[model samples]
Target chain A: MRNVAVRNLCCGVLLVAVLALAVWAGWVAWERYRAANRPLFHEIGWPDLVPAGWTPPDVLRGMNVNRYQDGDPEAIDALARMKNAWADAPAVKALDGRLVRIAGYVIPLDRENDEVHEFLLLPYFGACIHVPPPPSNQIIYVRSKAPLEGMMTMDTFWVDGTLQVSTTDSPWGQAGYTLQAYDTQHYEVPAQSNKS
Target chain B: MPGILSLALRSAWNRRTTLAFIVAAMVLATILLLSVTQARRSLHESFSQAVNGTDLIVGARGSNVQLLLYAVFHIGDATQNMSWASAQKLARHPAVAWSIPLSLGDSHRGFPVLATSQAYFEHLQVGHGELLQFSQGRMFNDVYDAVIGSEVAQRLGYAVGQRITLTHGAVAMPGAAHADKPFRVVGVLAPTGTPVDRTVHITLAGMEAIHLDWQAGAPLPGMHISAEAARRFDLTPKTITAQLLGLKRRSDVFAMQRAVADEAAEPLMGVLPGVTLDQLWELAGRGEQVLMGLAWVVAVAGIAGMVATLLASLQARRRELAILRAVGAGPWEILALLGLEGLGVTLAGMLLGVLLTASLLPLMSAWLEVHYGISLAGLSLDVTSVTMLALLLAGGVLGSLIPGVCAWRMSLSEGLAPRV
Candidate 1:
């Protein structure tokens, strides 16, 4: 009778060990599932950054800017005016301090070794050079909590952060929008193309 | 289980000579893999720590990478020097908070000599805004005073009062020495683990004082200005190699770069140090990847050898395993015995490999610091390293199981009557 009782006890311990392992594995799988189904931050698009019913100031309205010759005074004056207007571009105040995820091209500002600690995010590629910089509202100055590695200029990334609609002096004189990013992931185009 | 393990240990000892070779191979493979990773990491860290807190590097129009290498790292020569007038203009620009002008093309005992202002000591930073600190004395107070880096002082056995002469060019040519204007070592910098530790610093006025009578890379035929008399003349610098700028606002960097490009006085280029450094890494990244891949291949070969050695020994152990089966041991016991031997060998190799790597790091770091001015951090078991070790362990155990299974089948078939 004692031998039978010891055998039962051994079997019970083995069963408990196996069940504990299974429970731990199940918990890990469930956490992965939840993470995949629901992202940490709400994904936002470039259009959502601009406030509803707000439009850019048309500096060259009814004037054909291309017709002017190079070094023309009138054209230079118009260009200066347009740049000034863009520099003072308005930002959507409601989105201030909101935790969100947005994707854009990177223009690194500061680096420590191979990692970038600060950068500017633009909605399009080659926005900082060859073409005039976008309006202040369109630029997002990002300060990463942890330095980002293997990131280069113009690399597209989906950055998650708290977006602030504050206007600070920029290369363009004055710009709005800053992000304190907690996470940054390389951006990839979705395979599905329903709208197209 | 203890009995099986003891049997396994004794069996392994019987083939100790053969197993030792396998362990040595594993040791070498582990060292190769970990050293390569460590070297790559430290190289990047040392290069980036050379310069920090500076917003822009402006130089004469040329390759951006070349400009950064020469100005920040003192690694290469500049194609042309920007006029001092242009540097002053940029310094006076509203957006610029401060500027440190750098004049190169001189050396002292193979160490590059940098001629800058007092601001360099105040504003220049290394390794995350770490300011330059003096170990011996203060900044140069006179045109003939100089400051030496830690490595320069230690290697040359120089002190605060030691007097040193500068060479006109990067190499120490026969007649290029400025023997007439020997500088008094006013200060010695603390160790920074960057190129600064291998440099010699002097004031711009001192650099000008030495070259007052020299023109077009050579001293004039008849003019000889004594060090004291040379200072009496206007010691203003005409040109400089490059200038490091700090902007009032971080956002004004792009604008400053554009403004520097548009300067009407001369053709100058401004580059973001971080961006250029990234480009440099991208250029060298392919070579680094090839080296890492080679290390992995060597590790795989070492693990394969371990498997082959165990499998070859299995035939000789057939009779022994058969006897154990005849005596009261089961097939499972025989299998566990072989597996335990394999685990024990691999575990020993890994531990020894780690110890060897840790011991060699300081020696390797010293060599690199003397040759390349790059300092390496001590051995650290970060997540990546731990993960790699875990994967290697798994691979080793999985490889050993193959021989164990084969031995189990052999013992089951040939019990008590082994194939001699």
Candidate 2:
């Protein structure tokens, strides 16, 4: 009788403990799934361009973009990632055709002597040039009514325009969003934020 | 309950050294299996990205794999050059967006010299739609000017405004140098993980001018045409190695490829970069699978070692099991205790394996990227790896049953005292 009681006590306690752990894990996972699927209207940054919970999406974070040779599996996955980085970009349909101001580096697409009418706006420098391009959403194709002057590669600019959820394919890179620029200004690093 | 748990812990602590050895073996096996799987997957992924962006690679009719090797990767030599008339006809097609002619034969210190037009840099895309960028200077404009790739400049220690000469063939030997027409380095392209990094770019006209006075493979005897005087004559290339074409629509790729193959001008072929690349990977993937099978065998051996250690220690543990039976412990309880110890060791080993892989991957990946130019994705565990770990744990528990059943039977036969 005592042996049976002891066995029941030990196995019952362990089973309950394991069940508690499993339930906790399931609840946490559910919360995360909800957060990822929630309709969000917050202002986004470069990283936010990729859909929530996507892995291996950041162009510069993990791998060296230039190293994988042709016919290698890694090369194939990287190409698919580049081609379809913005596959689910339209999921955030609320942001389409909305007016938004974004700050980015200018990669001139069509330009004359000292001005540029159309350019790719990137979150960081060297994108679409030396480094593999970021996802489509991270790049914004901007066509300005008036040309911006003294523009060169890696020049930072703050552009105010209507964000249309569209993909533009250019020789430089594919962009998920196209902005019709009404205002443009140079972006300068603030003195306080420089070191802090 | 507490009594049974205490017994299992003390019993495991007695053979801690053997348990440690078993865990170490499992750790090594896990690392090897993971490295091979990750390397093969990443290689195929990176290669597909390079080929998918381009529509068609039009070259001389030969092996599909061979054309991919030279045209896309700049690896081997082209057997024969297609006539310029064939390339021009394909370029002028209404469906073609842009076409860049590639002429490969000469080399500068082992790096292939590609004599193409300005359109090569302007239209050629890498890693999605990324265009080429000049890291140091602009593209070559005049004859006798050269644009070096990032790897070529770094390896040869040549900078813009530096002068370098090309060899007649692809080898870096000291024979048949184009010494009279040394090219001036005008630009250095940024590091592109593609084959472009190891290429030296120049104009097709420049290639024609350098070989103007040459006949067959050697310079014409008793005839010297100065670089300036050679410019007076026609510098058009009569033949080129291949042409890379971009179509207005991707749907036009198959039609254009059919058109190139059925061309009356010359016997030529057009290969879709994506299709040919998949075929090449199919051949290489078989070898990788065989290697992975070997890795699985190593993992199984590690598990066998774990089971052997448990069984070897069972004889010494028989006396302990007999004493517990004398104290009214059930035969089933003996089996449970031994099985629990096995589960404990394997679960700990698996946790350690996860930590070791997470930390080791980032460190090894950095070295791999710098030296081999292969970048591994994030070290976060994938679904396949998680499934493998679960299998390892399950296999470890099943393996533990051998010694568990032995201890159970020994306790039944020898109730108060062990034979040993």
Candidate 3:
């Protein structure tokens, strides 16, 4: 009887001790974690480089730009649609040289649209207006020398002087993609027949 | 059953001195479990509320999380500044219901100085569309006047008419201070248990005023002016970091976002607050999960300790068992007596846990609101809670039965002889 009693007593002490240690260890670790987790508010300092261009519409200022990952399906679909439209990009061989005109969404035709005259060419249906803006889903730039009126629709046609692809970042499109335009024309959306 | 429970109660009461210590341990463990759950839930809700009713947060160009952090919580500094012109243009959009302009890069003491329009109070809603209320004075009335949060007032002890300088960062260092213009506290907001409580809110004009004599992050080199003199300058903020927009139609949010991205004027982006917050929660939940898991382990250890205490006492309970058997008690009755004791202890300890948790709600609320931008869920018995208690009670009873079964077998083998 005394043997069992002694054994049980030792087991009780061991269990309690181990549990107490676990509690203490957990508490110590939590305390250290709390102390180490001082808010990063005060520590914010100027970065070595200011972002170089119109930030991707998906990105925010002051946010660590390195953390943004654009995986929006709608934006991807829009990009794919534009890529499809640019396949033949309408007979560049037919109108080579002599300042020919073509229309597309004003994707920054050049990388430095903010500083230089460049931006990408997108489709007409995707224009975002003040009343119903494009989902902050894509970085669609319009290289219009003139102010834009109404929706920057996906189907609206614009004239690009020639294909000059400059990779330099635009003044405003910092840490972003800029496409420049040579002279571009904004085209009205053409009516489509309703064929089921 | 009463007789059996009476014997068990007497036995537990006799060892109550030791069992009571274990109960205290359970009380602490329960607090750890419940408090962590409450803290995390509250923080997420409170954070979502600080931005109130805005559908999207638009900024010059950066990460969505960055915009959410500064434009909403004011926890971090904004890296990019948007021209107030750009914000105004976005506001001109037909779909926009309202837009609150915000300028970053200024602080009052350690609290962030949010240069926002009064539209924030008009639009800001918290915890089920509740409007912001004042604990003391009203909102900022004058251009240089400020409205502080409850925590800011309590911590700095500033009141109406008390003047304070603005700092650029989260700290109170004078080097980061905009000492040229001192603003009076005209209003204070009630405690919202969110980042709003820790921030200092001022007019966008106020932000532009202090920054008028500065360029980038410094005073315009070789150009200087007094705060009073600067007030004479036009206060229209030429640029701002971001704008919060509410649309007439929720469906137009995406389209508007795309328009801003495609702006012929500037490269800009707008992000939905709910979507951004979810992304952040998924990313930041890793550390939180680890912490919660550790606390859960403590709760388990507490339950195990209770079981172990009951198990250990069985050996000392051998004489009591022998006396019962000799006095016409069956082996099953002896087991029942011990089982009831374990069950009673669990119920008692849990009762104590409920009391401890109830008493600690205020302290927990204060700690969470000040340290983390979370509001704690109030103390109430919910489905999850009922389920947890059921598991603990069932587990405790079953665990104590282990020793009861052993004693029953031994007593049957030895008849009236003491197993110990």
For this target, which candidate reaches the highest DockQ against the unseen true structure?
A: 1
Candidate 2 C-alpha lDDT tens digits along B342-415: 78778887787767777787777655444333445545467777787788888888888889898888888887
Q: How many collisions per candidate?
A: 0, 22, 78
Please state the Cα-based DockQ of model 2 relative to the true two-chain complex.
Answer: 0.02
Residue range A4-118, candidate 3, lDDT tens digits? 4457768999999999999999999999997686332211111211223423333233445344456565545555444333221111122222233444554221111012132
Q: Which residue pairs in candidate 1 have backbone atoms (N, alpha carbon, C) closer than 3 angstroms, thus clashing? A: none
The window of 10 residues in a row where model 2 chain B has the poorest summed lDDT is B367-376
Where model 1 places Cα greater than 4 Å from the true spot, the runs are: A1-102, A112-116, A135-137, A146-150, A163-171, A182-186, A190-196
Measured against the true structure, the TM-scores of the candidates, in listed sequence, are: 0.86, 0.62, 0.66
- Give the C-alpha miss distance for residue A148 in model 3, angstroms: 42
Off by over 4 Å in 2: A1-196, B1-21, B151-165, B168-170, B176-181, B209-234, B316-380
lDDT for model 3, please.
Answer: 0.64
Error of 3 at B106 (Å): 2.3
> What's the DockQ for every one of the candidates?
0.29, 0.02, 0.03
User: Docking category for candidate 2?
Assistant: incorrect
**In candidate 1, residue B404 scores what lDDT?**
90
Kindly list the per-residue Cα lDDT of model 1 for residues A18-55, writing each as its tens digit: 99999999999999997787546778898887777876
